[model samples]
Target: MTTFVLFGGTGDLAKRKIIPALYSAFVNGRLDANFSFIGVAREALDDADFRQRVLASVSASIEGSSANGGGSTPATLQAFLALTSYCKIDAREAADFEPLKQRIDTSGANAALFYLATGPDLFIPVVQQLAAHELVGDNARVVLEKPLGRDAQSAREINAALRTYLKEKQIYRIDHYLGKEMVQNLLVLRFANSFLEPLWNRKWIQDVQISISEQVGVESRGDFYDHTGALRDMVQNHLLQLLSIVAMEPPVNANPDAIRDEKVKVLRGLHKFTPEEVSKHTVRGQYRAGAIDGKPVISYQAEPGVPAASRTETFVAIRAEIDNWRWAGVPFFLRTGKRMASRSAEITINFKPIPYSIFGTNQRNLRSNRLVISLQPEESVELFLKTKEPGEGIRLSDVALNLDFAEASTSRRVESYERLLLDAMHGDLTLFVRDDELGAAWDWIDPILSAWQGDSEGLKSYISGSWGPAAASYLLAQCGSAWGEEYVED
Candidate 1:
């Protein structure tokens, strides 16, 4: 039997994401009947009350599942509800782990996972308590959720603390983006298909664009978002990880280290940005009051609990490059923002335009061939290829060869957390980030953060529903490029 323990079981993350993911995994037969869920929180709720709370959450989240004929049957719900147990514990106190140890021993499951869904401040203390109580055994694994730290130094400190008790192999640093089906398929899209491998380098690829936009502002998380901003919250973990996948060389093998080794190389290859270069290549913005989909929205500063003079950037755009051979001179444009026109996460790899066109100037209007991998709203891969328009004219038009992941499969697409949770249970490290990977990412990103600390030169403002600030467009224009049209349409 496998036992899953959630350290912050009653919090929003555990209730809204963790429990629902577990339910999905349970429904799909990924979780066994002998499995147990021990939810630990400081709220002091009993097993029945915790179950009731979870049930209500599950009911609301799974309502959409029910609409699609995927709801849990009554018996299935009862059986799943049976596997759950609750315990109240102060994560910081070593003595409070007594109940957890007793429950694990009584449950008779050697495989255990401690999911630290709590705040970053509590992570080290909880681990210390688990170690003190001998609750961390050879078969135990600890899963960490992100915004790991504010910067490189803090991240290193957290890593050092965890290393005291857990080895690198026993730690799973979750980056939910890597668990997305389409994001994983990027590996297959690049490596599995021989057709794309030829053009996956700087010689044929002109530029790369990675965008993560949100339609909604910080409705409830304004307090948390006030301090973090766009770069640390999104770019550090999610966008950079995606960039690594797209730019990394072919790994020696599909093993965890093999994949991560290539990823680290990409991160290290990232061209170091000097203070002057930062001003030229980076653009930061805060969204002001405007309308999104005809609904009025508040600015970042206007959000509740946020100071009026906040300099926190709700949007970030950077034109970066890797100094290595495979990606040298090929610019990578990364952008992320809140209160954008639409919510989307995608990467577009634009191939260089055909040289010395034999078809003459008439066909020059055709868009460049692009391979877009979209991760959100829907998971899909689209190839934009130039084709002749249906007429006597020799004009060319770009058409997409699309693969809709959801429509092609009868099996339900699992949420990112669901796939990640199951991978954690099975001791799969492929999707989980390694310590050095995290370190390397922060090491490269810290300079950009430092450059923005006291300077306000390039910070611009954009309307809430806009694509981003005008400077983002200017950054790309200097490279004779532009943001992909997907952002502008919505």
Candidate 2:
């Protein structure tokens, strides 16, 4: 039995992801029987108003969810609603926190999970207020959402402030991407499969690519997007985190810290860039006016709150290498962008090609085997292998041995938020980011950022609704490879 306090209970994230996820967890019996929610905000909403907002968010999410409300009976919904309450307190005002403190004390919550869904600026104040009011429980936990900071120094400041009041064990820095079923499945695919582990090293692999593309522009987030470009916004956290998981050495145990320790080693293993290497290994592109599916879209410069003179990159392609025995000489290509040809987030492993084709040179265009873990418009894994084409002749063709998690399973796919949020409630930090991991990631990223700051090379341009600038492909071409386009959404 625990109490959940949502700091940004009425914000867009809560409305779209958090609230729906909590409700789904409740419906699935993933939550404790004595669990409840305390929706905290400065909205001046009473208990009833907050419950209604939760209902609306839940209803909207339900309509689109494959769970279709998850066997939630009216009585159960009401029971869940009855467990909820609200508090209207300006976190900036220390006095207002007293009321929240009193309410928590009265409720007798064994442990409380404080979720800071608000901006980075609010994290410190809220933690300070919670400490001052004596509302922070010995068994309490705090959940932090990203972007942790605008950059490394800011992230360090935030961590320092939080540490002043909360113990490291009590902090859970959540990254929803890690909560995805397929991402979690990566462990099983590698460790559990005896056939794949021996060939997991650079000796049997060529290069790896982690591509996360988007077909949509900044929309209303131009103000935020303008200040944070592709490298800082995406590559620093999401992309780096993915790379760590893919490249990390096997941990000693399944303990949360053990897994995290290995992950941080990967981040630290990332080859730091020099000023000159930064320019040669990285490509930054801004989207220009172009067509998507036959319709034209405005350039990133024309987006609301954007400056026409803005050189902020909407797209970034990076060639990263881990300086470790397992991955030495194996390049990890990381690229992500807005207003691209497809909406995809996938990590593709290109295995080294056969030294000699058994079927003779007649097998034209014989390609390397590829293991693609896609987490996008669809959740699936496909192993592209060369197969003998059924015929009287010795013809070979590539075939995908596919594992579509959605199609093969009858159980409802768990939402990323649902998995991570529930894990936070259960005090499971396996999927959350650690402070050292974050620091190491920033350490590796800061040099490139500094180089980009001083670069006169300027931004390359890619037309909207494309796979970014041709320069991204060129980054791979240098290594005798290319970006995988087969999985791009149509």
Q: CA lDDT of each candidate?
A: 0.88, 0.89
- Candidate 2's C-alpha runs over 4 A off are 73-75, 486-490
Best by TM-score: 1
Instruction: Give the worst 10-residue stretch by lDDT in candidate 1.
Output: 62-71
Looking at model 1, residue 366 earns an lDDT score of 60
Whole-model lDDT, model 1: 0.88
TM-score for each model: 0.96, 0.95
lDDT of 1 by residue, 1-490 (tens): 8999998899888877889889878877888669999899999799999999878868877775542126578787888889998999997777789989999998989788999997777889999988888878889999998888888999999999999998888899998899998888899888899888888898999999999999988777777888889998899999999999999999988998999999989988999899889989999999999999999988888899789999999999999999998888999999999999899998999899878787887554565788888998888999998788788968777799999988889877778999999999999999988888899889888899999996966679999999989889988888878888633311
Strongest candidate by lDDT: 2
Residue runs of model 1 more than 4 Å from their true location after superposition = 66-71, 486-490
Residue 465 C-alpha lDDT in model 2: 87
- Pairs in steric clash, model 2: none
Query: For model 2, what is the C-alpha lDDT against the true structure?
Result: 0.89
